[model samples]
Target chain A: MKLNSIHSITSSELNAFFEENRQRTLCYLESRFPVLQEDDIEDIFQDSSITLFLKIQNNELLDLTSSLYTFFLSICINIARNKVNRSHPTYLLSDNITDSDFEPIRNDKLEELENLVGYEIAEEQTDQEYLNWIEQQVREGVRQMKPPCNQILWSFYWDGLSHRTIADMFGMKSEDVSKTQANRCKHKFSDFIKKVIASYER
Target chain B: MKDNSIYNEQIDRFLKGQMSTEEEQQFKTEIGQNPELKQQVREHLYLIRGIKQVKSQEEQKIILQEQHEQKVTPLRRNWIKITSIAASITFIMVLSGIEGSRLYYRHEIRQYAYNASVGVMSDFAASSRGTIDEETKVHLTDLFTNAQEGKDLAETIDELSRLYVLTKDEFVDIEDDCAYQIGWFLAVSYINDGDYEKALEIINNIESEYPDNEDIKSIQKQLVEFLK
Candidate 1:
């Protein structure tokens, strides 16, 4: 059986792919940004993997001209570069991180997947689309939370920006301040969701 | 607030696999024993998942928007917004009818996937690890190519099935995915030969042996999307 470019990817296959590239990807990131902690590097890689998984899940990726690992590696590097640039504004990134990097692969498969998720949820529960409903509340909570809390939580939670990067993005004094603020904002966001859920339940 | 913070941190640790085995065991036991703690943990999980889901949707939108440079329409989820408890019950009844039709619909799925078996050929070509000689490899290629084209499909499929049985029984302990990839090809051949049930059985067996293998799962998902 002759396989062409990887058109279909499974979650486990992707995990294997990520693990296969882990050591070399780590070396590449570390050589570029020595300040990155192992945890940070791990987080970046995991997030990139999740991004790739989401793309595959959403049917936003497939029909690769090159190897699957090559496409995956590009995603990892793109994510890392964005993180480093945000986390260290003083450090100059390249001039030509082009806007035309990758075109999101799209088709009707996304809608099909959405309907599949919806169907699965409906199969599991009947009272409400509570999962999606609560997710909506989370989105609202981001908006309704106090000025900086909304912005802070949006960056930290919705954007998956690191606390230090949040600090840098928001012009906060330090990461500690950012963490504390995020904690407060997260609580408020939780409260906002809890309150709405309580009413809906009633 | 500090208590909530401490509680949330513990949940975060557990979710991120940052907890030690002993600590994780203790946490699980506590959740088992304590209702309030369990609820809190569940709430934390839900909140984090909810936030991430929102993030995922937003990122998808951004990507799609960039691709089309046009406004992506809202998710067609009003059907999912299946309002009212009475309507939900009705929907469930309707769903039960769907469940009944599922098997009937599945044959069509099998037919579509059978036609899509050429994908397995790509899986074979991309692989580099095999002890098979050049002559046998050429023979297999000709067989697959003949099957792929419109020429002598049944005869081609029969020859492939013979090779499949010979290969499957012969390569019991072959290391790595080569054997399984061959199984995948044969399963596709079975489908092509109008033995959808046999193809599914073979697929299920492969899944049982290598539960986490995505190649098999990808095929499964592709087939199921017909139902979806």
Candidate 2:
């Protein structure tokens, strides 16, 4: 499949891409990066998969010229690189390292990595374990949130679709209507998260 | 809760890096000065990241099963044949009021092979007494004690899984070794519950990581043979 075709990517096709490349990617990672253990390799693979999905959704791959596997592996490599640089995230998060945890990469290494991955890597933020935990609630909220709101939030935030595109997709009356709906869904999701977090703390 | 919907668009732009540098700088100043805005920014990040994780997991579910099948259960074509045996494995050591010692089975396949797996788990529990971490040691004792007494099989499996994942994330090789040891007990726990497929999964994975262990190989052979 052409890399350019990601503009119209659908769910099934993306799953097929995953099933097809899943083994080969593991084999590739195991051979190329001996430092990563099995679980770490799987974690990196998942992160890279999400990164690829987000890039495609945002239309950020317009200039890419590599084949699908090459593009995907480039991501895995960069993530593995980051994995090597970090340690057990549980310890990091347990200390509540809020501001100091988002350690910026050195300029020289950052440039080298950015060039290799063909895109900018986010500055290392706080521990991924915390992000992973927060994401768990977000997922539950999305599934249990009111209908149309959940669907609308997914299409808007996740798919990166514009109001016009979402309106066309959802068959809403107009872009303005879709925008209003998307805004409401975002608030509902945010509120959903707030309530859930408060409950967990209690 | 106050209406924070007005800041949604601006937060989205800031989190998504859609803001210009100057806009981002001004927004960062505001966020630094306001605790509520900082909290909102985190929640929005959670929503965006969480939804994307959910979608990735949808794809992940299929691939994980396929990965499991590829590593272990290649004999899935004969799955129906095995299920028809009405297999209900019973560990005699499970003295938790779950039918004292009468090996419960509908078809009565060779009982000794399954017992051989139970023996392996008992030996692992014995040897693991003092050589592991105190934190893991506590769970390890409960895992085997519950297995021996046949207490709450579901909870045992869940706790073992959690323990395995937590130890693995700590990035210590000793914990990895401990986790592999724990896999044997978990596999037996599944076999005890008559969950042969899940048992085969852990055994096969352990075999892949440690191919030379004759005991693990023997357990795998016995499982496949009994299923046949």
Candidate 3:
């Protein structure tokens, strides 16, 4: 459906759509970020939903596309990016980037549609054993990290906390919190890749 | 040039956008000069990208499922199928526990499998063994032991291990209880093989939820004595 047409759906109807997509979105957000918490995820989506709903009401949405999910994902991503930027995240190296001229490419490598279809196919390929193994590894990796680091990182990444708020939540200097987060999580990212490759090799 | 450790840390921070403006400039300049650093940065990006790809795929699947559900003809009997599946699983679990002899056999077989592979079976076999009920460890140890025997422990352990070795070099698939069980077995085997300190260390790290478990308590006691 077109953006204008979809935008006409009532707030209650929009909420129902959000609820329907919640589980799938949660799984996506968790894997993508891996450090966000449930509450944070709920909050981010709640805010996103409200923002989207208002946008539609005000005719701010330029286009809604074919489905509610597409529109919702766009809204969520925009909100997330805004939140990340506002946090003034302290990446150990963020301070080093005095060259404001350098901008990283922020292209989308994964699509919401492709993911859903792929998941249908992947569901058969991923047996319980594999899922169990990956989940266990993730849990163990999280366990090894310092409690605050693990908690805050998961809260932001998996659960969708803005970096600024995460800083406030942890009560650390935002920059230091971000640095600790990035440093602690770097190892997990490497380790996760190694494990996935190892599993595929096996 | 940055020290290897510093360079790695810098690379990590740069990739995560944690670097300061000055440091980020320096990092970028270093990358400009060094092909190796550039490659490391690329690899890091790829890892993050790959994870995002997986996440996106999962999200898409959920959306697809919802759409599919909407288009598909509604089946009034889905609950029946779900209930049947649930019943079957419950039945299998119950059946597994039935007949004292069968339960004993399952427990004994697991212990035997552990003994065969790891060279030491903890008090899982001994009647007088302490009350530490290490359930999680039991499951993992059983799977590893069974896998070692290959073909469900109805076959030779070495032969099974060899046939499966090509699939995954890793000796164990520690899913849920399986990991805890096998980890414990491996730790104990290390101890039995005269690596007391390593055994103590390994056991200490391989945690069980039930600290008060009889088997765990006994192991802790054993570890304390060994340390002494």
Candidate 4:
């Protein structure tokens, strides 16, 4: 039987595939990142499998160019790398690591990072101290933004709500109005950061 | 201001990956030519990343607190424990049921083969009198006697298969009763040797070819049920 597509796989077949490839994925991670604990490897494996399964279920992974094992390995590698980045940021910085250096094979992660962060920051290499400083500045800017602007920006970006949803929440004239307001708020916030950076430089 | 709005819209589309291949290439070319626009894109990206990081930390703290609360609650803990036990029990029960059905079907097939063999032997004895050649008759009688006497059943089955093929080739004018007796003997030998697949195949053939034969029909029905 030629099982080329994910749709053709039965539940039992899927479970068997996961069980068989799980050990191989763990072994791959152990080889690549020996410092990762057994528990961390297991967590990465679980998270990768769940993410892959959900993507397949939702029809997000429509065209698979590689074998299932290759796809699985890529997901595990990406996840393990991200966990390492989060837990050992200083170590990563010492190695002169950057976000762009760890380009994921899966396009979903790339798209997600791009949407959450901007392309430049997503690609830039920086230390944890710089990241913390920028985070502080962003929080301050958000806090100082006038009444509804902060709330609108929070809803649109942080909460991942749509302009239409924000418009409905805040009783705006339309989705276009919500979008315009969001852009204005983003500019205002950006100006706050510029002022802070200018003062800090002086 | 118009250029900034257009640039922001373009940046948004680029970040979201909503652009076509051609548009993306064009935007990339534009970014390469313009350094100030590139800087603006970088700054915007950093701001977005910082905000996301702060929000993510807050969400993580909320998640950790919720998990801690769930662990502290005795009622929730008891419910989770009970559910896990119930699920384990149900899984074991399902596994046992599948194994039980497999054993039951095997027993049914063996019993049916034994009864069918006895009936075929009697029919052979009654029908073989003066019609079959003396030498062929002796050979078949010896084979059946050895099978009944609890001798090597695998050897008996192999001899039965050869005898069946010989009968079909050499005895064109043989009685219908004798021909069917040979086929039945071959099938029952297969069953006794635990070759149910071959036994079922012969039984199905007999049933289809002799649709009016009640005995073959009954055997076919039993084999089908055992298989199911």
Report iRMS values in order.
Answer: 16.4, 18.2, 16.8, 23.1
Count of backbone clashes, every candidate in sequence: 12, 0, 46, 1
Which residue pairs does candidate 2 place in steric collision? none
Of the true interface contacts, the fraction found in model 2 is 0.16
Per-residue C-alpha lDDT of model 3 across residues B59-81, encoded as one tens digit per residue? 32333233223333221122112
Give a tens-digit lDDT track for model 3, residues A85-200: 55535422232322221222222211211221221112244332343234334434444555555544444433333454445444557645665675556655556646664665
Task: Give the Cα lDDT of each candidate.
Answer: 0.49, 0.52, 0.41, 0.54
Candidate 3 lDDT at B20 equals 78
> Which residue ranges in model 3 land beyond 4 Å of their true spot?
A1-105, A108-162, A169-173, A191-202, B1-29, B32-36, B69-228
**A38-127, model 2: which lDDT tens digit per residue?**
998888777787777766544344333333445676688778766766754432222221222122112232222122221101123223
TM-score of chain B of each: 0.41, 0.43, 0.27, 0.49
Query: All models, DockQ values?
Result: 0.08, 0.08, 0.05, 0.06
Q: What is the interface RMSD of candidate 1, in Å?
A: 16.4
Candidate 2, residue B110: lDDT = 21
Q: Where in model 4 is the C-alpha error above 4 Å? A: A1-132, A143-146, B72-228
By lDDT rank, best first, the candidates go 4, 2, 1, 3
TM-score ranking, best first: 2, 1, 4, 3
> Any runs in candidate 1 off by more than 4 Å, and if so which?
A1-126, A129-135, A143-147, A158-161, B70-228
Clashing pairs in 4: A118-B45
Question: Of 3 and 4, which scores higher on DockQ?
Answer: 4
Q: What is candidate 3's DockQ?
A: 0.05
TM-score (chain A only) for the predictions, listed in order: 0.40, 0.39, 0.37, 0.41
TM-score of each: 0.37, 0.38, 0.29, 0.35
Assess the local accuracy of residue B150 in candidate 4 as a C-alpha lDDT between 0 and 100.
27
Candidate 4 chain A: minimum summed lDDT over ten consecutive residues — where? A97-106
